[model samples]
Target: DAGITQSPRYKITETGRQVTLMCHQTWSHSYMFWYRQDLGHGLRLIYYSAAADITDKGEVPDGYVVSRSKTENFPLTLESATRSQTSVYFCASSDWGSRNEQFFGPGTRLTVL
Candidate 1:
């Protein structure tokens, strides 16, 4: 079974283009999260969903959006890509009440020119 997976492991786009990153997990976890990893910021949370339709904004959400209509899938979209938004994004999931341990997918590296 695929524990967690991310699509388009790497992406390069123009400054004004839009980019969507996909994430999927076989485990039916109640919580899912999207995080971006950068040099100084480490891993900053971009968005999170407690359940299928309950989503919330995280530390960095200005240029990104996320939705989870199904328990196993959570996708993040950058409305208008920018060079500052270029970073390695990671998707993670955890069961309810188990916030300490999360399963993370192979990250997606996005570079905006």
Candidate 2:
């Protein structure tokens, strides 16, 4: 949609290196989330922020970090990326109060070789 999208749609990285993926949205949504989707697997939550200065870790947050200091920008960073961290990262956002309808980004593909 016109709300959210990711960067570096495809990426290749080496082991034990840091990589950062960017996510941006047009609407000033309150809830932003990061998720990774593996082959033949469901979307796994990585991190999410309720608003500026408020963030929380999701199911799989190890080796990954996120910050939402801005209402329209939420970026995810992979520190010391490993082979296991090679996957497609998707960013989503939802309205603050309604807590309904999540818009997904195109996704960033990071490959750790």
Candidate 3:
């Protein structure tokens, strides 16, 4: 039988630790976003930056922090990892317009034990 299948990805970590996830874009986009996906919340925005040195917290930004020092890079850090923070994190980038489409990354799944 000839079939194609995809492998599962996993990330494991301990509590009270710090983890940093990074995102980068090829284009010089002015806007970057970080989102976390959970069971009930679906996809919730964690943080977003309009430009360099300009960042704002999103809906679920309590345990997450984001920084944008350049147009092509945006890194998200978890201050203190917790079991409740186990979720998939996604990073996206877009140009400086409301009509522009946002491109998302493959996503990073982090599990805190």
Candidate 4:
């Protein structure tokens, strides 16, 4: 991928099944994030990491887990996928520069049944 990208761009899974969304970046930005976007709401943060091995929960972190073992990857997992967790997942990276603009990946569209 050129910059940031998510794997399994389209997924359909059943409830109680485990689902993991993958995010990768080529820029090696210090900050990475996972977000979910639904129909009526804005992009809600799931988790973020300032650097490798350093991560924190965001606004809506329930039913989700994240880890940054390497600088270029930040993956989000749902141990027991639920219907409520179905949404478009986005991966982003930023360097916290003067502008601090986040570069987003082509989102993953997940459907839970």
How do the predictions measure up, each by TM-score?
A: 0.97, 0.93, 0.87, 0.97
Residue range 1-113, candidate 1, lDDT tens digits? 67999998999999999899999999999999999999988999999999999999999999998989999999999999999999999999999878558999999999999
Query: How many clashes does each candidate structure show, in the order listed?
Result: 0, 0, 0, 0
Compose the digit string of candidate 3's lDDT tens values, residues 55-90.
Answer: 999998998887887877888888889999898888
Model 2 / residue 81 / CA error / Å:
0.4
For candidate 4, write residues 53-77 as lDDT tens digits: 9999999999999999999999999
Pairwise TM-score winner, candidates 3 and 4: 4
Error of model 3, residue 17, in angstroms: 0.4
* CA shift of 48, model 1, Å: 0.3
Q: Report the error of model 1 at residue 56, Å.
A: 0.2
Model 3 misplacement above 4 A: 1-10, 98-100
How does each model score on lDDT? 0.94, 0.90, 0.81, 0.94
Model 4 Cα shift for residue 112 (angstroms): 0.4
lDDT digits (tens) for residues 36-69 of candidate 2: 9998878999999989889999999999988888
User: What ranges in model 1 sit over 4 Å off?
Assistant: none
Whole-structure CA lDDT of model 2: 0.90
True lDDT of residue 11, candidate 2? 89
Clash pairs, candidate 4, are: none
Question: To one decimal, what is the Cα RMSD in angstroms of model 3 from the true structure?
Answer: 6.1
Residue 98 error for model 2, in Å? 3.0
